[model samples]
Target: MKKYVMAGAISSILSYQACVLAQENQSKSDFSKQSYFLDGFSRNNLDQEKVALSTHASRLVVQLATDYQQGMAIDWADYLFSEKLDGIRAIWTGDRLITRQGTPISAPSWFTDDLPDYAVEGELWAGRNRFEHVMSVVMDDKPDDMEWGSIRYMLFDLPNQPHDFVTRFDALVRFVDQTAAEHIQYVAHFPALSESHVQSLLTKVDQNGGEGLMLRKMTGGYDLGRSDNVLKLKLAIDAEALVIGHVEGKGKHEGRMGSIVVKTDDGKVFKIGTGFTDKQRGTPPEIGSLVTYRYNGYTKNGIPKFARYVRIDKSKQ
Candidate 1:
């Protein structure tokens, strides 16, 4: 009888421990699923590290645009073209501004005091061709008050709204008008242009140091991630690649870094030697870091032509 009692006690203890372990594992699994679902991402598609790092604290995710090809057939009349501002993409969550990557912006209180309680998606712009300046101002943990004064929250879209593009644009315009805030302004969307007219506009914008153009389908709804309804038209094709190795410099650049060997997401390997400043060559993008590069187009053998290093994607880290 004594032996049977002891055995029963041991079995109960083991069962309790097993139950606790199962509960812990289920809790972890639930947390992971919640994180991915909130961020509008799929756990199956992303790696473990990315899934762990994903955050949707802002409760908002902006829609992304696809690249536009020259002479691509589309209904021009159904789209609204706007100047692609060379600045950081920021999402205004009514109370505060957050980067597209979910990092919070530390703008001065006065900057957001006039914004509405609803969310607005736009870019933190510092005029045309002032990307670096805008980045310098907003990237700081504590933004500089005077520097932020020059920055503008260029309103573009209203995410999560049920209205079509035209209705949303009008609503955004009215909201900004009512606020009467200097730092907040609507991004002017131009009417559709002919193919020749688009080329002319691109030339003019390029000459003025603009980045490119964004075409928003007037009939489409705002959707998360890259959408076919929206397109980015740029002269040079730009893409992000992982830096795998570096080559030694020669001649004038001897003793310093030369070029970086990179592999695209599609497994295309290439080396970018140009577009690096002296400082960049000294401290090149570390191996395993993602870097953006610009190229004219792809060669017949699937190689990027005139590949030039653009910038390191610091957000990936």
Candidate 2:
């Protein structure tokens, strides 16, 4: 039996040290700030070892296109699938559990006191319908006792195994089956090898008020950045970026007119002024939307380029 060091039980009241630590890492602005600054193709290779166990934004899963059923994609035909989670995305570096964004998750000692020495990626879920509640519960360093009991830390990926994702996932399933912990369970990964299959799943998820599916490759190493091996198949056109600056208006767009400059994690910036109606422009997106701007990919940077505004993403708010 592998025994990992578990942090002492968390109290309902957070300690002064925890408060100070949270404040230090807290961002000044969630709107204009680059919240999801990591979901993209890396210009340079990121050092995975440099990433801390607690940072949620450090790791990325490879996205395998549904079209790619052969070659490396089939390496895990028996490995992946879709499952609804009413929790937050998390990763375990064997010893500690951290949110996808790198924040330390104050998981209850009882939840992960006996987890194996492997890095697993999944969600700290509460229920299929308690999505936001679970999200809120997991984000707090001082987790609520009542909420904690309602949540389950589901494990999906095993990082310590040197085998490909297929092999690693096999080990993960076995570990989950062998342990058979009460709340802990493994998420089944399904294969959507066609556009219709992917779209059908998306529709089903959306209709059921569920998020989209995660497409992962079977043959790739866990490299950072937006790799084709790991793609998020969602119905919405969402992207998070930094508000570099605001674009000036032209013609009737003078003064209170114009678009806003936004940059993705890969340093791709563009002016997005279209998509907005008069009411939207009047109040603008508060200089930042952290939004999902829709466009035709009219430019070289894979952005809408001279794109228009879309609705502000309140979920990210």
Candidate 3:
């Protein structure tokens, strides 16, 4: 049951042109109908608010990853890297799928009917640069069959397992195959051959519009909350902040949000104004929720320079 990560070397496997084509193929269409997957019987006639709050969340028991630090001491042989999928986190609790906040996500019967009884955690992804679309379809109280069909469940772990990462990943592979679910696949991992290998993978994913890479210790057992065993690597510095207030727009944005004031984990407060679209600006993250933002570095005053809004955390609210 215990083995290692990827057997092959992390080379130029992901084609750049194909990545461009894939990005080009990503939909900018209205959250209109498209794609496949999921089951939708119990939620056949439920309102979005009712379905979204299917469960009350007190804590996020799922294991979380820390931001990767450059030049960190890591024994290459003991760690593995997987593409940090830019999709919402989903926990399949035997019979249904829920967000990290324990909010229910209605899927069609076909989507969950064949999944194993044990809990599995993964990203509900559509593809690169399609985070918004994935959010639209997944957050809906009602299941969008066509859209769900094309969306995928890229599993990274089997929670509550008694084994290390390797065995857990091995178990995940078997579960994926045994179910024969087309929309379900394991997030492939490869050894951290060296810093170069990590950079290569990071570059490829970035070029293809991906966020970054996730590094996990091969020998570590899954632990809830942030752990050094898991880390995130990205080009720009990314972090989550607690929303404290909203700044209204003055001109064209006069009617909607101009920016949001957020407090970082360390208590640094700032406003994220750039990187939001018109649609998103109109509906900013609510107060008391969490939001992920990107920044370059800190200024002399200890503020994140050029902070940009990324995505709002839906788990808290």
Which candidate comes out best when scored by lDDT? 3
TM-score of each: 0.78, 0.55, 0.78
User: Once superposed on the true structure, which residue ranges of model 1 sit more than 4 Å away at CA?
Assistant: 1-60
The residue-by-residue lDDT of candidate 2 on 9-100, one tens digit each, is: 43343232332212212322311121111122231332234223322345433222342322333333322335444356677776787665
lDDT per residue (tens digit) for residues 101-217 in model 3:
777888888888877766788999888878878888888888879989878888888776656676666666656655656777767665576777677767877876888888888
Off by over 4 Å in 2: 1-79, 83-87, 242-317
Ranking by lDDT: 3, 1, 2
lDDT of each: 0.70, 0.54, 0.72
Candidate 2 has its poorest 10 consecutive residues by lDDT at 30-39
Give the higher-TM-score candidate: 1 or 2.
Answer: 1
- Model 2: how far is 43 from its true place, Å? 36
RMSD of each: 21.8, 15.0, 9.1
> Any idea what lDDT model 1 has?
0.70
- Select the stronger candidate by TM-score from 2 and 3: 3
- Kindly list the per-residue Cα lDDT of model 1 for residues 56-126, writing each as its tens digit: 66444468899987778898867766778778888776567788888788889999998766667888887
